[model samples]
Target: MKQAIYYAQLTKKANEYLSCLYDIAQTLVSFDDYDDAKMYLVKISQYKITDHVIKEKAMQDLINVQRILTGLEDRYEKEDDLQKKMSLAEKCADTYSCLDRNERSKYYYLKQLKHAQELNLNEDQMATIYSSLGSIYQDLKEWQLSIDYFRREMSCRIGLGIQADIE
Candidate 1:
């Protein structure tokens, strides 16, 4: 009973943190103040939540802020004053807290595919790319595509020394 109560309290606290962070993240997004928003995001990164829906939503929000920041980069590029130009450019660069983890993972996955297509991809390379593409499709809810890629990956892995296990 005590353990359950403790867990409940912990869950409540986590919810509060997420709620507050969401509010702040959304609000700061409007200020043209990337620094402050990025700081708030970093602070909120401390809590580990295993909830997939919440995590996905939070990732989407972060991606929104990042897209806005990317749009603002052009403003920095137009600045002519040397000092102001440098400062703004640096701020623009710094605003990228990190690539969306999902995007980064997908990027590498696609990169492998490109490499495989460009070069003579051995069975192991094909297997790796197939596995990556499968995971990406799965996350995107393209179940058939995911299954197809996973199967291809497994089949390629079969003849190679390293096999991809799509879970």
Candidate 2:
């Protein structure tokens, strides 16, 4: 009987912690404060009341949020270095893509592609951007746009005297 009561108490506490963690996650998104959210996630993940699964899930969410925040922060911080800025922008786009935020991914990818063009990056760099855009459009099921971007990528590779090898 004592063991059953103890288990019940533990379960109740775990449920409460899980609810609190979820509430915090929603609040973080609403507030758009990644730094604080990261800290909060870390703290929540450490709560002994929650089970391993909940803890792991919280950690994964922290990683995703951190990646997005870092990409956005780094992209703006390296304004003078167009290459670095583009790289960070690409990371941001990829992170959003992984999170299933295709609209944001497309927006950031297009923005970076424009920046790359304005800066007159090398063919290889431009080709890479075109490839990324092509893949993104393909994922979004915009078939015509995807084909056009892929063709642009092929043109870029051809200009650089390289053969496209199914990439």
Candidate 3:
């Protein structure tokens, strides 16, 4: 990895530099070093890689992840079981959240909330989802929406006999 970084810097040509960055990023992703992988991937994007294969591999697997999310959404829509729908929604939400696609995450979380309500899930289970939605709204600077969800979460916690210090 150090060698790859050194070669990436040492290379004068754009193609060589991009290839080295791709290699480093690919290796990082395989090791679950996503933070480092994201760094190298961003570096690759900064340079124009004429090679499409290198571009696809380095730029994501991210492209494929979106495909996977879409597939999950399609399956969720077609699914007859509420449990399965919740699971799919969770996968989509978590993936979108990790990608910093908060709007998409919000969508799935809403779906999950709907399913949980339909299933009569305990307040404890729903509370965390409310908290997540609250934080998401906060991140997007939707103050009233954030306060609404936080209030809902607070209600859930209270209903579950959990005491919290409210500010």
Candidate 4:
């Protein structure tokens, strides 16, 4: 009980720091400083904030950063530095990857499909990935995969006997 309280307090503090970092990044974006904005976004992501609200906010911030990154990538026409261009592209993809494709999240279901094929995400990671997939499928009225992924997640949660506020 005491440990849980301590953990919660720590998470709250980290969340506050993340919020500050996000503001700095937003300011950089407003100034057309894409590199600095991306750097700050990555830094904020390193802050450990397990509180559901904070984590959700952080994920949303990542999605926003991804959009900005996309615009930046498009604006840069020079391709003299192949490695740098590749690195920037990868970072842009990674930014989108941070956002789960839930209803609240701004990601498309196709992102999860591409992710599952590209990365062999494990059960916990898969749960997050597949849940997002499930939600999108549900929205599109595609019942088969939606039911399959949802049941897979439910089975895993039941096996772990973990209390999940999935709904």
Candidate 5:
């Protein structure tokens, strides 16, 4: 009886969180405000719900909401500001990574690399890209590729006179 009651309470709390998430999504659609939507999605995604299904669905919704806000192809082409364009690409890469779509993440990361190179962004900025690529490759267990990217990142940091432990 106690177990049943505990489970009932858990289910009720989970349902409430799901309902709140759905309400936020509806509000986003109605307001057409991507920033606010992203904020809400971030909050919901970080929330700790005891239900696995609800948590998974909330994560998926967060990814979808982020994609709707970023709109890589459309926004990337239409954006005139270099900084904003780079930001969108980064957001796309992050969202894809969160979804475990590593290929898409790499695609956007490569795009960011190209943009950074073309715009002559500082070593610090480029290093961030290199570090991200290194992390991705490490996750993929591509040891040689990961080492190369990490080396590139280290080189950038060295160029900027930033001392870091190589170990």
Candidate 6:
């Protein structure tokens, strides 16, 4: 039965398989079996997903499960070159932020900020990091910390002769 289902999925009737997946995910999520749902999405990501509802979700979950959460993070930890490390940190932070995982977002942003400071990157780069940190803090509801970071961003802008405005 499982082999037949697998063969059907790989053949010309792939869309039939694709359309059922989102329903399966919904049922799994309702049952709080989120891990299994995510795996199903990942498994079907190889196909051209025409199902609008599941396409975006499946791709995001695929990257989140396969790369950003695991591969990129592991690479970040093992990476030695400061520039490459900073790049990975920024990518991880941005991806996590987009995924609404703000805690992990904040962590990677701080990692990027630390590397930026250690390398004595230019004011513009520092300002961007400060701004990103500020936004993360705002999302996290750490008002005081957010204000401090915005202030740092302002200072960076002023030092760079750019008119600074804080929202």
**Candidate 6 C-alpha lDDT tens digits along 38-131:** 7777656766646666677767755664455357888999999999999999998987776567888999999999998889898888899999
Single out the weakest 10-residue window by summed lDDT for candidate 3.
61-70
User: Considering every candidate listed, which one attains the maximal lDDT?
Assistant: 6
Q: What are the lDDT figures for the candidates, one per model?
A: 0.58, 0.73, 0.73, 0.54, 0.69, 0.76
lDDT (Cα, 0-100) at 125 in candidate 5: 86
Model 3 clash tally, residue pairs: 0
Write out the backbone clash pairs for model 2: none
How well is each residue in 1-167 modelled by candidate 4, as lDDT tens digits? 23443554576576655566666666665665657766767765665544466556655665666675567346323444544443444444344434322332323334444444355445675566556656656765679868876876675556542224344
Question: Please, what are the lDDT tens digits per residue for candidate 2 over residues 1-167?
Answer: 23443554576777655656545664664566767667767877777767777677677767778886766656555577777777777877877675556777898899789788878887788889989899999999999899888887887788843234344
Which has the higher lDDT value, candidate number 1 or candidate number 6? 6
Going through the candidates in the order shown, the clash numbers are 0, 0, 0, 0, 0, 0
What are the runs in model 5 whose C-alpha is more than 4 Å off? 1-66, 69-72, 160-167
Q: How far is 56's C-alpha from truth in model 6 (Å)? A: 2.5
What does the lDDT come to for candidate 4? 0.54
Instruction: Give every collision pair in model 4.
Output: none
Model 3 TM-score relative to the real fold: 0.58
TM-score of candidate 6 to 2 decimals? 0.66
Which 10 consecutive positions of candidate 5 have the poorest summed lDDT?
1-10
User: For model 3, what is the error of residue 93's alpha carbon versus the real structure, in angstroms, after optimal superposition?
Assistant: 1.2
Query: Which regions in candidate 6 have their CA more than 4 angstroms from the true location?
Result: 1-37, 40-54, 160-167
